[model samples]
Target: MTFTPHILESALLLLATFLIGCAIGFVLRRFLAKPSKLVSTKAEAPVGAKPQKKVAAASPTKAAPAKKGARPAARKQTPPQSDSAESQAIDAGTEEDDLKKISGIGPKLENELKASGILTYAQIAGWSARTIDEMDAKLNARGRIKRDDWVRQAKALNKAKASA
Candidate 1:
C-alpha cells in the first residue's frame, strides 16, 4: 500500500498529542499526590548497639513555610517503655545474631529488626502471638513472621548457637 502525506501527518500529530498528554498527566500526578507521613529520620544503629534517644526541640507558635514538593518534617515521639523493656530483656550484653538466617529475612529486614531492638535469636524464639502481631505492625511484615515460621527457625538456631 502506498502511504499518503496526509496519513503520515495525521499519525505524527496523534503521537505528539499523546506524548504531550502523558507529560502533563505525569507532572500533575507528581505534584498532586499526598505525601506519606511514615518518613523515618532516625539513623540505623549498628547491631547490638543501644539506640540513641532523640531530644525534642521546642516548637515556635508560628510554623515555617515548607518548600513546594518537599516532604513535611517527620515528627519525633517518645518511644514506648515496652520497647525498651523488650530490648533490655534480650540485650543483657549478648552478642547480636545474624537474623538473615531466619527464613524470609534478608539484609534489609535484619537491619529493620535491629533498628527495632530485636538483635538475638532468643528474642524471636520468645515472641508470643500478641508479640508477633505487634511486630507485624511495627515491622510492616504483614504476618511474615508466622508465614515464614520464624519462631521455629529461631528456636533451632538458638539451640545450635547454645550448643556451639
Candidate 2:
C-alpha cells in the first residue's frame, strides 16, 4: 500500500480524537470522585484540648551519687509523695498478682513494674496520686494510668486478693 494524503489526514484525526477523549476522561475522573472516608478521615485531637507528651521508660537501676565538682547526668525523678499510703516500702519476694491481668499492661510493663519493686496489687492499690504519676511517667504509659483507671482496678484487685 502507498502512503497518501487522505490516509495521513485520517490517521491524524483519529490520534487527535483519542488524545482529546483521554483528557476528558481524566478531567471527569478528577472532578466527579467522592472522597473515601477511610482515606480522608485523620486522627486529630479536638480543638481546645491540651496536647499530651509521651516519654519512654527509664532504666530501673539507680545511679551512684555524683562526686563533688561534677555535673550529674539528668535522671528521671522518682515522684515525691507527702501522703502516707505509699510511704510504706514495696515488699519484694512476696507472692504477687500477674500485673499483665490489668488492661493496657503487657508482659513488658509487668516486668518493668517488678523491676521497680512493684510486685503486688496491694502496692499498686496504695499508690498516691504522686506515686501514680511517677509510675505512669516511669512506664512511659502516656497517661494510660488515668485513662485506664488503673488505681481503681488495683484497689478492687487487692480487695479480691484479700478475700481469695
Judging by lDDT against the true structure, name the best candidate.
1
Q: Write the per-residue lDDT of candidate 2 for residues 52-95, one digit (tens) a residue.
A: 88987877687576688998679988986444332445655577
> Who wins the TM-score comparison?
1
Candidate 1, which segments miss by more than 4 Å at Cα?
Answer: 1-8, 15-92
TM-score of 2: 0.46
Can you tell me which runs of candidate 2 are displaced by over 4 Å? 1-88
List the global CA lDDT of all models.
0.81, 0.76
Cα RMSD (angstroms) for every candidate in the order listed: 16.5, 15.3
* Model 2 lDDT, residue 37, Cα: 64
Write one digit per residue (lDDT tens) for candidate 1, span 10-49.
9999999999999999999899989768979896443334
At residue 102, candidate 1 shows an lDDT of 96
